[model samples]
Target chain A: MSPMPTESAIAEKRQQILQGAMEIFLHQGYEGTSMDRVATAAGVSKITIYKHFADKEGLFTALIEQIAEQRFNRVLGGIYLEKEPEEVLRHIATQILQLIASDEQYVAFFRLIMGESGRFPELAQLFVRALPQRAWKVLGNYFATHPKLDIANPEATARIFTGTVISYAITQYILHGEQIAPMPSDVLIENLVHLIVNQSSS
Target chain B: MSPMPTESAIAEKRQQILQGAMEIFLHQGYEGTSMDRVATAAGVSKITIYKHFADKEGLFTALIEQIAEQRFNRVLGGIYLEKEPEEVLRHIATQILQLIASDEQYVAFFRLIMGESGRFPELAQLFVRALPQRAWKVLGNYFATHPKLDIANPEATARIFTGTVISYAITQYILHGEQIAPMPSDVLIENLVHLIVNQSSS
Candidate 1:
């Protein structure tokens, strides 16, 4: 443009591009999506897109990072040591189930990751680093700090808790549980919370 | 005239075709795999494959059925009413983890099912019926009959048990847990069994 864009304008444009890219990526998947498609979808000049992201992989990485941040906020943001462990655990489990089970975009994004991970393992690695690993660390640290819980092993407990919720999500949402028989989300969350709290307290 | 194929010959050819189909399906996926490719991999004529199977879908179905049967045998083969609930649950858990975690072929097949499921939902339905649904029925029935365990909801309890193990396997194997940190199998099993048995008895 003839005039320089303002910082706010640049930030707004970047967000627009990322949102467009995520829509395309979720629908077409990583292999099927292209930078040109993203540019068109965003209604931005190729130059502007390139200004924000280096390439498709770069754009995809940015998109994943953005999603992870948003998800972390929605799911883990409320978790606090000040809250009782049951309340915190229930919040985490419920948020996770809501995100992974009910959200079509999140489920599709996960499917895209699982489908494309073999070819683009780096993307999978990026997701792993961004989400599950980070979540485990946060939860593990929380468990370790609360010795009153008497968890035999914080790391293993974290894995079990996260793993149970994730597994329930994958089966119910991704793996066609709707056609088979749907397990209500509350039931799953209740069972998981009970198991973890009971075992840890004992 | 060609000599008529014997019973054993027909069985051998079918097994060869199934084995070859499994390898190609795991490698190339459902869409990438072709009947001709299966014929070549099996070292049998396309005509022979067609004779044994109605079409590509049929071949894949047969292959899935075969895998399910074998897995059911290996994993749930030892369960008996006479065994201790603890022993039976532990056996089931160990077999499941061993099958899903370490078996590359099983993991690859699962990936194939998940990847293609969005496009070919029938395959996912077939898989759900063949494995998880079947396992749930058997385990649910077991839990329902064993009043000593006092499981409030056998169906939900079964889902929780199987879901926990399957989720752990997927995280550790499919979701790139190796890049993150790995949890030992025994620790997960120990925690899960303890939780289930304690809750049921209490």
Candidate 2:
């Protein structure tokens, strides 16, 4: 109507569609979701959704990719990879918990993925490739290079680091295990840091 | 027909209904699944299912409780609480992987829990209370009594232990992250045990 949508405007519209897709897909689930529902949720025409995404699968795949990039980049962005192990691990642990605390949507999306994994295995695969795979690699290389840590296997250590923190987040927030198995996130972070940086106890 | 079912016979039928509920609920989801579907899958009449389970929620609650007791008891039953940290931790780790490896049904049920947690928060709560809560308590108490490990806070340490191993299982089996971020379960188990008992490096 006004001028044709510019590149940035178009990108903004696309992001809006994805965000709406997340909400609808989570509520209706992958099988239950439809382009019509997504369009309604996004406040856009069905044709507009089709313009942005080839199909529901494409929309979902994009959703996984975007959520992964946004959350991981935000959590991993602040840390200087070269910092001491104690500082780096603490920063990572703190950032992860902080991000989970702030973002209910992301946590909900995680639930959707886990719940739908059996029906839509490819979605789970895309998520693994997008998020935890990258995390394991970055931390694995860090462990491998940090001679001081003396880790025999960097890859496994990387999984443990990311796994422990993520597990805590899932248990506390998603599983509501805080009531049943309460441990302050700070305590876990510090203890995890101590375990990794202070390995080889007397 | 036969005389009224004996106590053990009634118990067996109850178990069958729960198993069918798990399958239907896993496939159709919590909201999508109904008693009829469970009856068909379970080879029992809907009336029989009603005789045993009051509603879908009751059936699901029973599923959580039974799964927690069966797998956890199988895992925790063999380990003597009196063992050293190395022996105890390793035994728990191995037993978990073994159980996960052998039982696809349990793995699928885990995915179902994660996926359905959002819609049915109460189911998730039941699971945490039944499963992780017990594990955390046992391990926390074990760590507290074992002065040899010198753990300042056994509760957090217990969380780390269960959290790490469970996360590993989720990644390797549920997320299918093994190929992308491959670290054999044995490698992770050993590293985790090392971190816990081998803290305080030179």
Candidate 3:
């Protein structure tokens, strides 16, 4: 009889599968990709992948969750209400801009999502739940707690702030802002921060 | 022998072809659509379409220009610098929100452009030139001429203002805001206009 895999082994194998799945999904897109392709790319048996994830949909969901977690960790990780609001906001904006502009994988993933979400609208819902929805809740709560800032509508303000950042990213990366007059990331971020912070000051 | 078509007939035929092309392009996307389909949809011969437009690329460009012109007329045609700044800004905001949210053709066209633009980046450039770039110039010029406003960086401010509105549209419509906690369009526009107008006032 074959020996049972250790817990660590199982975790490592799951990670390998997810990483391989993301690469294929981003490159070939959701519909173009298949379980067989993911298995081949991961160099694991199809059975092994199934053991980790129920099916292709489950795998895609898991991948999105992973991405959201990784992004949250990278940008807003360790950030909280206690940190200076300006510094935290700047860091978040800078990180988001860098991810949007410089990260090839993120851009490819974004394009894949936008391209496929029309056909598979559930994917759009999954993404909205995974990232922006969660982020808005967290940030809005932070804003609400901080009475000094005097934000009238924390939820709406959070959406607007993040929405602006996201819009800049989409315009710059996805919409060919470079071919047009490229607004420097710093200028955009600075202006956004100034608008938000200064609005409160006044 | 067939007599030459009159100028009015030619214009009518061209309009028919463009209308058909828009429907097909929005439904099937750019790469999926073809000249033969457009001809069939328009109830015209392939030669007739070619007579109006040189090729598929030409037809596509003409269609984008038509969309831009139609949208401009509908939204900003009667708008002018002489109007109150608040009224003008609010009008523009309302018009943009209506277009982005309620216009099915525009949403489908936007999806088509975004979905296909990665493969055919020239489409992105074409769209940029057709709409937002031109709108920005006109709006920026209006802002600059308004000496009473005391605006700093008219160009950047105009971009930010419009960018915020566009971002709201994208999030609410394309990105599935309804699945999340939906914010009404009026709230977003009101908040955005308040932010910009109040920022200058302070």
Each model: TM-score of chain B? 0.83, 0.83, 0.83
Task: Give the runs in model 3 whose Cα sits over 4 Å from its true position.
Answer: A1-72, A78-83, A200-202, B1-18, B30-72, B200-202
lDDT of each: 0.77, 0.81, 0.75
Could you tell me which 10 consecutive residues in candidate 1 chain A have the lowest summed lDDT? A193-202
RMSD of each: 4.2, 3.5, 4.2
Instruction: State the displacement of the C-alpha of residue B181, model 2, in Å, after optimal TM-score superposition.
Output: 1.9
Q: lDDT per residue, candidate 1, A124-200, as tens digits?
A: 67677777888889988888887557677777778778877886777667877776777787887776776677673
Candidate 1 docking DockQ:
0.41
TM-score of chain A of 3: 0.81
Give the best candidate by TM-score: 2
Docking class of 1: acceptable
- DockQ ranking from best candidate downward: 2, 1, 3
Candidate 3, backbone clash total = 0
Error of 2 at B75 (Å): 2.5
Which wins on TM-score, candidate 1 or candidate 3? 3
Residue range with the least summed lDDT across 10 consecutive positions in model 2 chain A: A70-79
User: Ranking by TM-score, best first?
Assistant: 2, 3, 1
For model 3, how does the per-residue alpha-carbon lDDT over B1-202 read when each residue is reduced to its tens digit? Answer: 9999799988999999999999887766666678899999999899989888989888987887677667666656766667778777888988888877788777776776666566667767767766777777888887788765666566767777777778777666776667575888778777776666666433
Candidate 1 lDDT at B61 equals 72
